[model samples]
Target: MTGLVIVGHGTRSAAGVEQFAALVERVRRRGDLGDVEGGFIELSRPPLTDAVGALVARGHRALVALPLVLTGAGHGKGDIPAAMAREQQRHPGLSYRYGRPLGPHPLLHDALEQRIDAALTGASTAGADAGTGLSGADAGTKLSGADRAGTWVALIGRGSTDPDANAEVAKVARLLWEGRGYAGVEPGFISLAQPSVPAVLERLRRLGARRIVVAPYFLFAGVLPDRIVAQSAEFAAAHPDLDVRVAEVIGDCDALADLVRERYAEALGGDIRMNCDTCAYRVLMPGFADKVGRPQRPHDHPDDPVDHHHHHGHDHHHDHDHGSVAVVGGGPGPDDLITVRGRALLDAADVVVVDRLAPQGLLAGLRPDVLVVDAAKVPRGPSMAQETINAALVSHAKAGRRVVRLKGGDPYVFGRGHEEVQACTAAGVPVTVVPGVSSALAAPALAGVPVTHRGVAHDVTVVSGHLPPGHPDSLVDWAALARARGTVVLLMAVDTIAKIASVLIEHGRAPQTPVLAVQDAGLPEQRSVSARLDEIGASAAREGIRPPAVFVVGPVVALPTTGPTV
Candidate 1:
């Protein structure tokens, strides 16, 4: 049976050291692995070599090394691996498989939510009533249902010099905010990064949050966690009108132990999928180009037995390639609807060129330093020329910066995505496209109008309505579409719907054919206007339905409602 070694970046705090040991014990108690040991790479007791030796003494030669970290920072990506390599030199015939860092995992998110809930519960019990002269958790009570919704969260992370690692914290903040009902969740760092604990709390206050909870996104009690608590308390003391509470760090819990075991299993099974797209040692980030292809070295530990005098004369060279561009679909309106590949590209991007109808909420979660070019082409209003937009993408890619052109719905569904691709190809820039959920189908479906129904409608046709029925540049066959006994979905046709409707009716189409116009589909402001084919234009105009809308025409639109009205 293979043993497991839980590697941690050792801390000065005895409590943290104890907690790490406790977690190892918890994992050992599961009895799934042969032997389990926990050790630190630096600062604390039981160095990595000692842990390896202990497992070897227990007759376990093969081992799995798992990093007890929340993100892929310098420690996980460099220090721990280098230290493990040194162990091989010390012990002959010893082998180990390395695991990825512990998080951005669902289990960690669940743990964070539990901690936040506990803090809120504890705050209520402690009479954390604003302006009541009672501060902290001195007086015990529970918060009402209303108070829960009014509460905002400030998640604090141990900041890193690596921008990728720092961005992970912001991603965690966004993940915590999703679905979990709170006023909002903001990311802050204890050090190295922007938006310090105090600054985040102040921003929350400025945003009109009356009750705020500071949730430390740490695995155990450490100096950084303690600093987070102190900063939160200081912020609370300064603002008597606000109810503030600090959640405990994720300590030695079964959930965390299970997560460690999962990582161990993954390492043993060779299922590790470490995120290298944004790794500073691989990607060419703005100020971190020097880090790319840099060799890893173990950090000096105070408790290490070795004196550690080594010389570096190795000449390592790597060819840096120019960056590429991705034309990604942002789905309809909600950021969650974006494809996984598209989201990943966005996360790795140095610059994002966004369209008017793209999911704008995603921009909020991007790294603070990412450049966002607004290429919004508002119909009959202000617009950015396509030539200028194409130039921006090529220029950014040529400058060795990852660029993403974020468009709404599917990039190919009348999104002019191919035009951008051609332009990039002509400019000798590498370009790829990520498909998205098109609003043409999503809008009608979201509005409870199916584009096609069995027997009722056997076919569905999607058309662009940018021009009226008889325009010189229009290519849509209105008469042919009218004769078809199927669904006809119209995109970019809100303004020309009146003339288009007349032409359809003048042909073989019935005036009473059911029609549904859905605006801002898949979004909070989404709403629909329904009427007969003949009256759809007037109905939509009367309802003030605007662009970024989808119009569905067919007997399928008359089907019984199967979803929410919006």
Candidate 2:
């Protein structure tokens, strides 16, 4: 049977060492693997060589070495592998298969949720004890739905120099926030990255979160975890009104041990698939361009007996090829409305060129290092020239970075997405178009105004009203539209609704035709105004309805209350 060696980046703290050993014991207790041992590359206790030797002494020549890390950083990608290579030299005939880092896994997410729940429970108990005169078990209970909704989470990770590793933490935070009923979840680092523990906590407070839980995304008790707690305490003391609680690290639990076993099995089965798309050493990320194609070297451990000689001769020359660009439709307002494919692309993107009407909340979940170019074209205000935006997309894709041009609603619906696509194609860059839920249809539907009804309206026409009815550049057949009995949905027509209404009425459409204008449709601030075809322009203007408002005309506008069955 192949033995398992759990490789860890050793910590200075004795507690951390003990916890790591406990986790090893937990994994060993499973009994499927004949022999299991764990050791660190640097800092504390039984060095990697010791663990390898122990397994070797136990008659286990073939071994599976799994990195006990949340992300594939320098330690997992380079240091541990380099150290294992040295072991192969020492043992002469020993062989081992390296495993991928164990993180962004479902089991780890469950473990984090448990920790967060515990923190909230403990806080609830403390509050009960202070006021309700309750004690012990009676006081400790799960927080109510209201309490959970009011609280925000700050996921803290032992930050790394690798941008890819840091991004993994942000990804975890985003995953944790999904469907968990928290106010929000933001990622912060204990070291080596931006938005430190205190900084994230302050941000949470500023966002109107009274209760905050700082969940350390660590595997065991370590100096970093301790520091996270201390920093949280200091911040809590400073802002006495804020209820800040620190959740414990994911200590030696069965969930973690199970994950280790799974990793060990994967390593033995040669199922190791590392995500290199966003790796700093492979991808040319912004602010970390120097790391691209960089060679990996062994970390120097002060406690190790071997005389470590730094090797700089081994160089890896990777082809920094151009990455593909994705024109993703961000859907109407809410981030949750974005398509699964769109969200996935955004998650993998190195650069996101965002439009003004796109889901802005999605930006908070992106990696802190990602370059977000605000390509927002504010109505009648500052706007990014379409040429400049198109050039930016091609340039980023050519630079070996995944670029996402995030547009609001459907990219094809007057979003000028095709123009950008042509630019990318001209530059020899591959581009993909992911369709979104357009506000043109979504706005009217959300306002209880269906564009189509079996008996009420058989057809619906969508038109852009950016130009007045009589403008020289206008292509809309006002007379033809007026003759049609079907519903007409007008987008970007808020500014010139009066002229369009007059033209429609003059062209034989009834002046008293029911009209519904839905503004900021499918959003929390969504509001609707109702008037006749002739009165819609004046009514919308008087009600302060702005651009992005959808105007639905004809019998279908009143279908929600008194229209066809289907």
Candidate 3:
């Protein structure tokens, strides 16, 4: 006789553990196998050892260890297998085979799509129907065409230390949005990664999402997904007009149950097919090639392992005080576009002072207790006061908190990051600056208009158009810039583009020079406006382009498929 053991990355939450246990029970009730049991790799109750001993006692010689995780990450490929190896040494007579992680599979994708549909429909007709969950034709019927056009779906993954695992969730999000007609699907993380749910939700609001749904990629209800739910509520409360809803976790659904059984069958027959394509060791992933083929080494001290079976298990490695401020550039608009160093700092920070233009999707996935300071006040007139933002950075640093001042684009590229850096220095606070992909170049490139192209332009100049052409406070040499032979990328020039274009034309710059304006830069809602230098302002006005946009002037603006022509 053979027995099946379902191995889960156990959690501290009793409810979470119960959910996994219930899933195991559901699989057993189906009654297709002889003997079945559930166990944990770590943290929560009955360990895998207990499950193995019990099964062997129940007169079983062969067993299968099925890892119930979304990716073949450390837990799936290393930890679980290592633990199983230990058990194998203990029971020489018993034989067991390991199965693959449960993800990148079509069934998993189907479950996520179903979760999205249920969330959208449930919110649309919540109070009207009691106990109705996407029945019959309602499952296929979209909530509303208007809502569908404006809604954004945010998929929250239990972020992993392995970058490949973290990236898989993003791929899943993109695939879900490819053919579906929702406004967009954004990738978010719940733990150990960027683009937190709240950040993504706020970003969706800024990108004009009429309603947003946050769907967790967890196979069971756990602490991380619970935090995602709370973050959604917090964001909804903050922005009363924005409708935020959380979809169900991939619970003990039939699809997941079927997936578990399939893995069991595979493990029993010695047919484990691991995902090698995304494996860092086999594939040359940018920064992880050195990790290739390294044998799994155990680091858990048995006492201070990752899981503690208690609520206080997740302490974010802040035993020492980092009484300094890290000025992190968030890159253009996309969450994943930010550099790896910048993201790592965000995950470890105790206080994150963020700008409106920062990669907001990263915020939604932060630890539930991390203090997030909204620093988007307008510098001069409306919005958050820059003085206040500077004061917050200085104060937070002085208070001995690990502070991360997150800004959009390069900190020095018209982001006012230098001013904040200077303020911290003046306040006797240590500061470190992490460079990021500036919107100036990122926006243009994302729009298919590189600032400089081979044989098209040799040099590129980036200038802030916030002060207009002839403002006394402006330091830019308009006439000199007009004479340049390369591309000119302008930021903060939306309102004053007409004057700037006029000044360039007056300064002997070509009136017919190609111009491209990219709004909402690297996001899915990004729109491009293209026109000759003389008519760009009119074209921008006609197309309703907004600020935080970049305008590219020169032949490179014509590099992309002409955008929306004037």
Candidate 4:
């Protein structure tokens, strides 16, 4: 029976020595060879010369020495071979052969794949923590492949001095990315790489990646791998949004035995026989002797298997002319008070049809490429008619482009959003409406006034003061509203403020009822004036306030302010 000897270049770092020990333990567990042992070449106890001398004393001949270096250059190429030559000469009667280093092998790719699988699939136990839970199906629920797309694996290792050594590790990571269908694969070093593991994880978070797994691309358990794992754990803990897992270190499996055997075949002889019985002896290797052995997968391809013959074709469809129009309600005057979605639409708009009500400062967020068309621009005196504005909205949509109709407050409340939607629909174009924080309510609230209070008022009525024509009818029946002890809010009533206040006072309503006029509701220029129903008209005139203001009146207006304190 032939004996196998695995040799590693001993390092001063304790982590490096532990990695070598783990590899030797793995090789010893494989029950295929007669004797399996490992020795360190330098910088460590149990040096190669002494170990070979001991093996020769045991009468083991035809010993195959394998180098566990990650690269074929440097120590594996020169120093280890030179040491073997000196050992063979010291033991003149012992016959020996030296094998190649473990680099650029499909087996290394396999090891990486296994690490990824373990990190992604999670631990075997029901509630094991380290696992990322990447199984395609779990508990009778199948997960879509796209759902796992953002799952990333970053291979972190101790940087190599040799450029070729670094390239080899990077190449293995690339192969694993393609083979496993990962969303992204990145090669990082604890020292050398531009994007360290932490930097890469930060970038992944910005990219909206939900889960990341760090696979240490080191052979045996080592110091650097431990540090990298610890760093990965700390990074994961900092970000609760991302799930992170540290995978098992490479070269801790017997499949690596096949890698060592293949490299040996490339060195001294050729490939080994498939059957273990044909070999000289069946021996136990380290890490491979689980009493029951980790249960074999029922179906190795638990999910989709690679189909070499399966081909797909790209299908081209007709160019969609679904012209989109963005209707934004620029709430009162404040830009930040607008919904986030509304702002996004306005920023990307092709054409922004702003009215006289929208604040000019809020329009600064529009993209430079956007075409601003002021539909309500009173060029000489007054703006375009309502029918003309509606026609313009229909024309923009029919041209197959984005149109943003910026309005003030809730578009439906007084901005006429339904009218624009109907016009777009009639033109066979698409329309999306983004509701904003209506100034009708925000205005009163920001002015230290609550339209509804526990006992003061249980109901509120909102109406436009201007009638469509001269039929002399307001939306709210003033006679009926005067009888109810509720609040009343008015929009675009500045021109008729004196008349409305007189109407309420004449309808058997108290002239001393609290009234609040909130101007520029949410903007920096916001101002609020509190007075009685009769004094509101005089107070507003004194303040020189104009239209686009909200008027609120009722007993609820007397409630204590809920706004910020001085």
Candidate 5:
């Protein structure tokens, strides 16, 4: 049988859960759904993972996970899908399709309109706004100037870090105002990003709005909704005869229940809807032009050509889990060079699968609860197997653990990060990538050797030296690199530095070209040794240079850090 999983952004308020559950029950009463269950993204019982387990226990091999959100914000686009995908990974034979959020859907508009009408009716019946024609039950009843003259609405959204989601709130506010008889609809946020309630209220007043209805765009009553109501009360108290009223949340209405069924059906029928025409990946737009035509593969159909690397029996622990992988680049072996966001994610990670190349100091400083898996890959040496590492990631995430793939340097730059991403995605796992400072550029700069200089070098080509220049597996075009009158940066070339230098010299590079090698770049034990191209290999051997070193080969290496810091 097919299952319907409703995922809500959980709240601490018990009333919020009761309202959400009532809606879930309303949907379940529909004869079309089988084994319907609801869960929260955070802070509540029957989390997304448990919701899946409930359906699985009821003999549901196929399920549809629907998001109960108003917009495609972080929760809708990332967290909910990630949690669902990770849960899917746990139940191998089980297949599921994810549905988008309830919002921006026409039915949502209808429900919100209903809430507005109910608020207006209550005020009208109570004779609060006596002269205001907004008192009538008939929505189409023409409003007098006294009614529309200073009437406006302030929509309260749980403002998000995602700009697009916040913009949607503003857009919906405008859509709700069109021919709806209210003076205007002002958009405001309950918290986080953007126009606060007080600010939006003040703005509305400036725009000639006298009477206002503060409507929270939340699906259920929660602490946020309570705060919205409290804020409205405070504002009303501050302004005498303001005629400000707080509307109930978008509660258990027929429209909302119907929309949940619609989303579920859409997921089953593959009729998922979101604003995709303007997606940055599809069309080149300002500030996002570079992402043009990139393959945006979120949903993996059974028909997709894939290579699955993971296999497991009914190793049953229907535990609370959401499988996700964060591939983070730890940067040139230093904890300090890690980005602020990277550090935050690291601190929040439950399991950190680290590479041998990542900063060892950071590992020592990690929270004691963090389970560290050493995926330490050594150049031509013993290390964690790539397949096993991929499996470990899947395993931990399926067990409802957050896994961070911590590597040295930028994950995509010869770090085989793309492979990890492919692995996780193929296994129906969600992956997040965080780029770090590559040794290719950092090694050169920290050693006072600029890879690119205006008058000295026009380009900088980063190449891997894991294989010698003549080795068939080596992808570096030594001949082209040698002929180019620019800096050539080499990483993982310590063992083959001599042969690589010889190949470049043979391929037309000047034997007198200066070469500078920086070992353990960015580390306290950093060492920079310089020699001519012809003598670098011998000099490195004499200095007993090791792997995890970067070499800069070009005329720019001849320049010193003589220029002061900009």
Candidate 6:
């Protein structure tokens, strides 16, 4: 009898395990396969050992290992294959094959349709319908075959670093966006990647899409998906002009069972005879002779052999358990201004990995031999890519060097340090971050402008100036920012000064409201400009002053300057 093994990336949540188990059982009840079993590679499990052991004990000779992953990366590409290889070795008599992940499945489209129907129906009950009177029939349209010709769908997934995984999501997105008859399809990620859900939604809305459905391509309902739902609500609320709906996550369905069965069949060799002597099954038969009825293979299996050179064509001698590197933020160009903890790390750094903004004065007192690298960069021009910087930090730290990934300001605040931290952690290189003063607050103070001074401003908001164009956080509630009864400071926005000012002015920030641009602040090249919010762009353009520039806007900025003593 053929055995089907469904594997999941085990989670700590018991509820998640129960869901997986229930899914497996439901598929089993359909009587599609001879035997159905579930296994986990990590966390909760009837681990692979037990799952395969049970199947082998049941006299199953052919087995299929179906990875319940949304994409083929990390676990799907490497770990699952490794586990299956181990299982194959242990049960040499069993012929097992692994299958592709259940991504871009049409059933996922069905789940999306159901979710949209539920949302719209709930909306109608709440009296939010616009009289399009889109019933279930209108709401639940699939982007398949001819119906997809002009159709476009935005398929959003939780982003992964594995290129293959992202490629799979992108492939599915292309099918929905370009293949279908709809207007277009877009692939985006909730985190760890770009074309964030909000950006994708906005783009689709602007595409003159009379009807736009925001399909979430997630396998489970977790924090990220919940966040996407909440964001969808906010997005729809913001754009009452657009018809938007958030779809449900991919759930248990008969299609998933079919996918598992397909995997099983593939493992058993779809075109080749299952009982042929040249089969992989010969390894299990051992002394049965007939040369195991297969080709005389080399003694070394390349997949299992250890190679000193890694797949990346780089020399890697680091152990798997290297401690994380230390990425400390030095704040915006100050030595003593750095947090005491950040300073300590700076002093102790074996390799003072500085960005363009790390004050040289701070590094002056450091050990001369300490390695210092310039990773600081800007966008749209010559600068280091985030991916490159992250790799360098992880690689150096893995080599047992104390790395200080010193950023210009607060590491967590738009510094891209989170990306670095994730890369390091994924590579088994530990990381610790120390906070520093962000220019958002400091620049205003240095210019005799208080973000909040009683009766001058009540609310203070600090926003990044150079958020990537397609960033999820780039969409500001400009009206909210404009209505700030207090001070507003924008950091690193030299390039966006014109646009930021325009948005504010349009949203009720008075054209006459005083705004100050502090350039190269806290250093010798420091310069300051005071202009009305409307004229700030003109002033910046005239001065030809670029970043690292901060914009301070508020009535407090109109306060009389106390000279350079400020």
- For model 4, residues 1-566, the per-residue Cα lDDT tens digits are 67777887554456556656665665667656557777765554456666666667778867888887766534554557666776666667666776766766778777676666666655432112243332222321333465347578787755542344556667777887884667887787774324567887788778777777788777755546666777787788788667777777664456666787666655457442222321111322221111111221111111112232321111211111224576778776666677666765665466788887775676786656667887774424677777787788877655544678888777888777898888776655557677876777888887778778887889998867765223356456776766778998887777777778888888877999888888777666777777899888888999988766889989888877666211
- Residue by residue across 239-351, what tens digits does model 3's lDDT show? 77766777787776678888988888787777877768878656656534333564663223233333422221233232112256889999998999888878877876768
**Off by more than 4 A, model 5:** 123-149, 277-566
Comparing 1 with 2 on lDDT, the higher-scoring candidate is 1
Indicate which candidate wins on lDDT: 1
Q: Residue 62 in candidate 5 has what lDDT? A: 86
Instruction: Provide the global lDDT of candidate 2 against the true structure.
Output: 0.82
Off by over 4 Å in 3: 123-149, 281-284, 289-294, 297-566
TM accuracy, model 1: 0.53
Q: Indicate the TM-score of model 2.
A: 0.53
lDDT, ranked from best to worst: 1, 2, 3, 5, 6, 4
- Per-candidate TM equals 0.53, 0.53, 0.51, 0.43, 0.53, 0.45
Worst 10 residues of 1 by lDDT: 311-320
Candidate 1 vs candidate 6, TM-score winner: 1
Question: What does each candidate score in C-alpha RMSD?
Answer: 16.3, 16.4, 16.9, 26.1, 13.0, 23.2
Residues 1-566 of candidate 1 have per-residue lDDT tens digits of 78899999877678988888888888888898768898888767778878988998888878899999999988899888898888887878888999999889989999888777777766321212221221454423565556568889999998775788899999999999898888799999886567889999999999999878888899888778888877787878888888888887888888898898789889989999988888988886764543566577775565567765421111211011236788999998888999877887787778999999999999998998889999999998999999999999988887657789999999999999999999998876668888999998889878887777888999999999999999999888899999999999999998999998999999989999999888899888888888998999899999999988999999988888866444
Q: Poorest 10 consecutive residues of model 5 by lDDT?
A: 125-134
User: Which has the higher TM-score value, candidate number 3 or candidate number 6?
Assistant: 3
Worst 10 residues of 3 by lDDT: 127-136
Cα lDDT for residue 303, candidate 3: 30
lDDT of 5 by residue, 1-566 (tens): 47888988766678878888888888889867878998875666556667778889888888888888888865677667766766767888888888987777677777676666656555331211221222222333444545644568899898764456778999999888887777889899976545889888888877766678787898877777878877777777787656676777777767888888878878888997687665544544432222344332222212222243432222323232344688888888778887655676676577899998887788777777779998987767788888999899988877656678998999999999999988888876667788988989888777777888989999989988888977878777889888999999998888899999999999999999999999888777788899999999999999999988999998898886853121
